[model samples]
Target: MTSTKIIHEKKNSDMKKLLGILLSISLLLAGCSISDKNKDLSQEHLVLSTIWFQKSPEAKALFYQAFNIAKERVVEFNKEEGEKPKAVVVDLDETMIDNSPFQGKMVEEGKPYNPEFWAEWTKLSQAKATPGAKDFTLFCDSIGVEVIYLSNRLTTELEWTMRNLDSLGFAFVTPNNFLLVDETSAKEPRREKVAEQYDIILLLGDNLNDFAEVFQHRGDDWGVSVVEKYKNEFGRRFIIFPNPMYGDWEKSIYNNERGLNENEKFKLRRKAVTAF
Candidate 1:
């Protein structure tokens, strides 16, 4: 055979081999993609249910400790001759109400935070009750310990919010008990309002500001410091629920806005991270 013919045959053979390898890799990756999608769907459903209804062991233990403390405080305060124990104030979203569905939609659609989306979701009145939240609130009611929901959720969502809680088995408190913030993003005023009506013995939430205004001005570092300062209140006057899926912690790492594109946010995140 001529050398030219041999070279052409060799090139053709190499090309065929490369094409076969590429096809194999493509199929493998496609399979992996499908598997990953399935896994994500399953995990999302499980997490959604867990957030809405099932309490993890850690959450249950924390709830029990807080419940006992609140119960004791109520009893002690009520023992007073005339003054009655006030109420247990709680944050609604992620504190007592499971917004996992909203979060799941965000994750699935690769969408960022948008007030309109949240407003619409809140109107759906489908958010389920967090585990132990319903029972605890009911217990507070049964014991005459008023339960108040102080939320950052807009006042426009009030009616739907109430309906959501009611549908989720959370006892509907009077309109006064639902203190939805009207406009200000700051929670100090809400806390002050609660203080006026309730003795505010116990404050429950997933964030530090839910308890005090110390970190309201300072950012994440100050928030962390404040949490450390009040570490003793963890299971006592301040009950917290775990919400790793989303919270101020995530916001601390990334700017809490939907305006930034994913790549921009990713670049920012990369800048924040470092390798030793």
Candidate 2:
């Protein structure tokens, strides 16, 4: 073939190859868009969890049981480790107060969590105390043990959080006792700060990460595995409340992915469930 013709043919071939690659990429993106569109994104999955949290007698019983056990553990700690000043660390959201109303609103509207709505919810300062939480904290205060609320809520929400606690008649609702998220969501640093001043006799939270660093950044099975490893400390050193609505456990189900759309989250959640 003539050299000019050969060069022209090669240029045509390269152009065709580039076009094929572009077509493949376009098709792949189109397929992904359609798949996401078809997947369920409504907050329907939150219904049962919200219902159980807001309406179930069993849920209330569990909270009361956990705090009752916590009281006993506190007495034990004072008897055994009475030499040092002590404190009890607690997570505010599900540990000391109920936010199921927020969850229920989401379910009712068939929408996922909206930061704006959540901010408004916090501003309202309407969350009620979980069963037995007030009594337990007050009991600790009466006995001279410090009650520190270490929560992941942003520092900006501190005022409303305090108002909510105060409205619920919580004892020791002071700025020094309430530590909200500042630099990071991890509680270890904040817990360490409390440890420096007082021996933390007990830790109360719905999520395992509230107690230790071991529970953070693990696989789906890591939560269960770590819990098993510390099984003996459940009632004594850890008082876990029920929080079926949302937690790190759900994040693990999605492989700890951040900013996953509701559709992607629903798919992972369904895949994580066992079926016959």
Query: Which stretches of candidate 2 lie above 4 Å from their native place?
Result: 1-41, 81-83
**Candidate 1, residues 1-276: lDDT per residue as tens digits?**
999999999999999999999999999999999876754553342345445434467766665666666667666655555354477788988778777777777657545558998887888988877667888788777877788898888888888988877777777556777877687877889888777656776788887777787756546463677777878877777777666666665566565555565556666667667689
Displacement of residue 169 (Cα, Å) in model 2 is 0.8
Return the top candidate by TM-score. 2
Candidate models: Cα lDDT each:
0.73, 0.88
Candidate 1: clashing pairs of residues? none
lDDT of 1: 0.73
What is the TM-score (0 to 1) of candidate 2? 0.83
| Best model number under lDDT | 2
